[model samples]
Target: MSAEATPLSIHLADDAATALFGEDLLLALQIGDCVALYGDLGAGKSTLSRALIRALAGDPDLEVPSPTFTLVQSYDLKIPIAHFDLYRLSDESELDELGLEEALAEGICLIEWPSKAGRALPKNRIEIHLAFAPDGGRTLTIQAPEGRLSRLRRVIEIRRFLDGHGHKEAHRQHLTGDASNRAYEHVYPVDGSARLVLMDAPKRPNGPPIRDGKPYSQLVHLAEDVRPFVAIGQALRERGFAAPNVLAQDLDAGLLLLEDLGEDGVLDSEGRPIAERYRASAACLAAIHDKPFDREIVLPGGHRHRIPDFDRAAMKFEGELLLDWHLPWKRDGQLATVEERTRYLAIWDKLIDEISDADTSIVMRDFHSPNIIWREDRDGYDRVGLIDFQDAMIGPAAYDLVSLVQDARVTIERPLMDQLMADYLSLRAMGPDFDESRFLKSWAIMSAQRACKLNGLWVRLKDRDGKPGYMRHLPRTLWHLTVAFEHPVLAPLRNWCIEAGIELPESPA
Candidate 1:
């Protein structure tokens, strides 16, 4: 171990504390981690291991038998786990027969009595030493490599946050995480009556400057901290929308305890879009756009979050993702030539100019299915719960409509998408000064722009981030792009894509 590796000590007052520690540790663990437990007989090693395994299984009452006699116990879970008791091993080489290497390769391995394995143990494993405390409790000292220690410390910080907020005994279950660094958990109270969501979004550091001494996120106006979410969510809730109420927050820490909006989304159990829910969501967007909104929102503690404009530069930067990532990935690392890229940017420049005078509103940048929730028990617009709107911008209202009807993640059939567009237009038309002709043109431009961004974003996620699962949405996004090109405003871009050998479905008659 490196000399810089420091030991973190904790007091476990009882079994509950140990179990909570196990759950906290689960948040920090990833695949290929090895945790070596050192403790004397009946020193609470078994308790901690069992709690961790049960938490990983997401079943608190799961039966986790001791592996003392069997030597090893393996579980196939969300992330597979292998529990090993090295006490019975006669030689260090016996680890080979026990599949230690294979276990470490696939998932986490928790080893008890690791001293028996001697030098065969992993060099970078986390070491946890449990001992009896003078006050009749257990004291645990943990030492881990720097990378793991950082994550562990973050998890502990979150635990302390919860403890301060009167949820010291709440159960934390991993809910969902997105492509960004933000993660969420369902916090169930001890009484199990109601659940809340814990948003763990640490303030992101600025990346290497991609353009004009600013990172891509800054150029595109992405939220770097939780302030925008708090401000926007409060604004939405005050407008009587179903944005979750912020219960507690640590602004600097980027943590928020939010009202749980329930699990019912706009998709059916089979993941197909429900037309009624989609229509409701469209109507909700129309309602949001109809009202005149304030650009500068005052947050709690007298802080202000001024929404940024989705300007021409931001749109161009996003559209260039297609050239930067998608084309290279599709063409086997062949980048777009300077001439081709110039032509592409010229086309987008004209399109953005055309939409410059279009109707503007607070654009929830990602108003798609994944970010929407369905609240059937509510009525009208309240039935559509809005989540994940931290990246709000003052932009063309039609951009959000395109995001909805041409959802990148799911296939919105032509008929349904048309119906949704019509419904949204009719609703907007009811308001004063609505221009369908101008709105349609802006919608077409934004649709193509968003499709370009997503097409490259999916590839970038796969190649750069090692998240290949996002590639599954490539065909859907491509199809959406083809649909967008069906608009007369996008004809030039369509021709450019064709000349560049970008495969797009034929525009329908």
Candidate 2:
């Protein structure tokens, strides 16, 4: 194994601080990792393990009893976790009977009294040595063998980064995430001051070239790092929209300390979309659509990122995920033939070309309910706070409008969708040269394209990423597919679905 940087040592003032440390470290774990907890009796090892397990389970009140007698306790989480206490084991060979190797292979294992297993402890693991602090507290000194440095080092880097930003003593709580590589933490300063949201989206490694020696992200103008977010949020703030203000940044590491937009969103307590909030959000979109989108946004370090246009190739490739992953999964492991794939692309090709004919503007690719924070304290469309715009691109203005009305996460009733459409057009018509008919045509085409893309995206998330919960959204997506069929432009794609025995919910049912 290659050498890594120095060991990261952390001092926790109390059990609360230990719990918080556990929460931060838990995010960095993966399957097959064995976190060996080494400490004397009552050094807060069990306390730390409980906090980590509860954080991973997303339930603070979860009961996690000591496993000294039970030996092992496993929980089925997004990443399965096995909590093991080896204090009662007589010999290292007992691990074979306890199935330690098999457990480690299947999921993350938290091993207590690892010395009981002695040399049997996994070589590739993180070892945390805890002890009593001089001042009535606990201390933790973390040591990761070089083979395990990649996991723990990132965790240490986050703490160092936060320390440099005047938030060294901030308490971090995990925020629920969506289908993105980014992880968010609600950073609350110990002084009860204003909170900040920490976005940790590291620069992704480039994949094999898919087109013109570019990966899919580059081909489609998807933001590969947080630089686009800083640049785009600045442009929006300058234009009077409410995007989170960047407080501190480490762009090289893809980390940002942003102003917390608060927990209140466009959705109500029952998770239903509020019409007034939706209207405000739609107005926000109309306001930005007329801005200068083709211009380059200045980023840090004298970097300029020109927003790429949503070209034909990018649009078609998105729909290909349907043919590539969704179709084959639906076919019970049978892959689509070359002829079927060709026909699918031909249908989408027409839609892509026709939609690209319309006027282009910045399309906040995901302007749906989940990304919009409703700040009632603010006035007008400023009340609508926009988040998650890293995937923004110069696409048809109608694309974001469609994203808002035909939201994938929440259902917007037919009447409310119609009202939002009218509100947007009326707002835009007051501005320069607005074509209602052309905009409507573009909306239909883009909405249809988005629906087709989502139909497969949900399945791909389930099969490729091991997120089967997305399958629950598949039915709503199919209903959306049928609604798009109302637009005659999508008839060819609809007819193909019929031939493929793909079920579509009866329109307006």
Candidate 3:
């Protein structure tokens, strides 16, 4: 083991505590992880393994038979697990025949009596030594590779946070996370009552300065901590929107127990956009834009969250994503020339200048299908429950509308998108000083801006972040840009794209 392999000790008072520890381990575990359990005959290795397997299966009643006789037993769950009891193995080389390598390649592995394997185990396996305590309980000494120690420590912190609150016995189930660093979990009470959401967002550390001594996140005004969510959600709720209520919070720790806004999003059962829900969402945005909003929002404990402006710097920075990531990716590792970058940025500068006096509101930076919840029980604008607005900024009202009508994740047909746009425009036109022509121009500029940002963002997420799935949206974003360039304001960008060999489809699909 490396010199940095430090052991963490934990005492489990009873079976329930041991089970909870298993759940914590599940949270920390990833695919290809090997957990080696070391204990004597009557220690809690089997108990811990069973608890972890059951938790991964999301079934408390799952039958996890011991693999002692079989040597290896596999379970096909969310993250496939292979439970191995190598005590019966006669030779270490038999591990290959038992598919130990395959198990570790495809999913997680739990090994009991791992000593039988000799040096066949992976070097970075997590080791858990369990022993009987003097008080008839169990004690565990756990050590993991240095690269994985941070995740294990985070799991321990989450458990402590839950215990400090009134949810020591809550059953935790992992929820799908977004592209950001934040993660979430469903916390169910011991009594099987309503569930809550645990937002586990750690404060983001500053990266190497990209420009003017600021990182990309700071330039684009991304939320660094959970305070923005707390403040923005409170502001939205006070304005009659259905943002999730904060049940409990730890600002310093970036943890929040939020009311579980149910999983009915704007998409239907088949993952297609529901027209009525889309219209409702547009109306909700209109209602939000029409209201007067304060720049500084008072959070709990009298602290304030000052909403940042979507300034020219932010807009230019985002537009450059296309130049930085997408263009190079399209050209097979060849970067854009200095002159091409200068021209692309110049076009963006003009577009941003054109939208200088456009309608301003508290723009939810990601007001799209994924962030929108369809609350059927609620009426009017309240029917649309908002989440994931921590990165909200004060910017062009048309930007949110663009996010909805031209959703990044889903393809919204031109007809339905037009109707949704009309739904929002008609409502906003009733307000004082609403200029249809100017708003449409701003809408076109913002649409093209968003398209440029997303085109580069998808490539960055794929190449730099190891997330290739986001690349699937590249075609749709290109289509959106093509549509945006139909407006006269984006003609310069359209010509530049054509000159740069970026294809723009002539017709919508």
Which has the better TM-score: candidate 2, or candidate 3?
3
In the range 168-258, model 3's lDDT, one tens digit per residue, is 7788988878888899999998878799999999998898899999999999999999999999998899999999999888899999999
> Which digits, one per residue and each the tens of the lDDT, describe model 2 over residues 242-355?
999999999989999999888898888997889988998888898899777545988767988777777788788887877877788889978888888888889988877777
Model 1 C-alpha lDDT per residue in residues 246-359, reported as the tens digit of each score: 999999999999998889988888888899999999999999998777899998689999999999999999999999999998799999999999999999999999998899
lDDT of each: 0.90, 0.84, 0.91
lDDT (Cα, 0-100) at 68 in candidate 3: 91
Off by over 4 Å in 2: 1-20, 30-33, 41-85, 91-109, 118-125, 130-148, 507-509
**For every candidate structure, what is the RMSD over all alpha carbons to the true structure, in angstroms?**
1.7, 4.0, 1.3
Clashes of each: 0, 0, 0
Candidate 3 ranges beyond 4 A from true positions: 506-509
TM-score of 3: 0.97
Instruction: Report the error of model 3 at residue 49, Å.
Output: 1.7
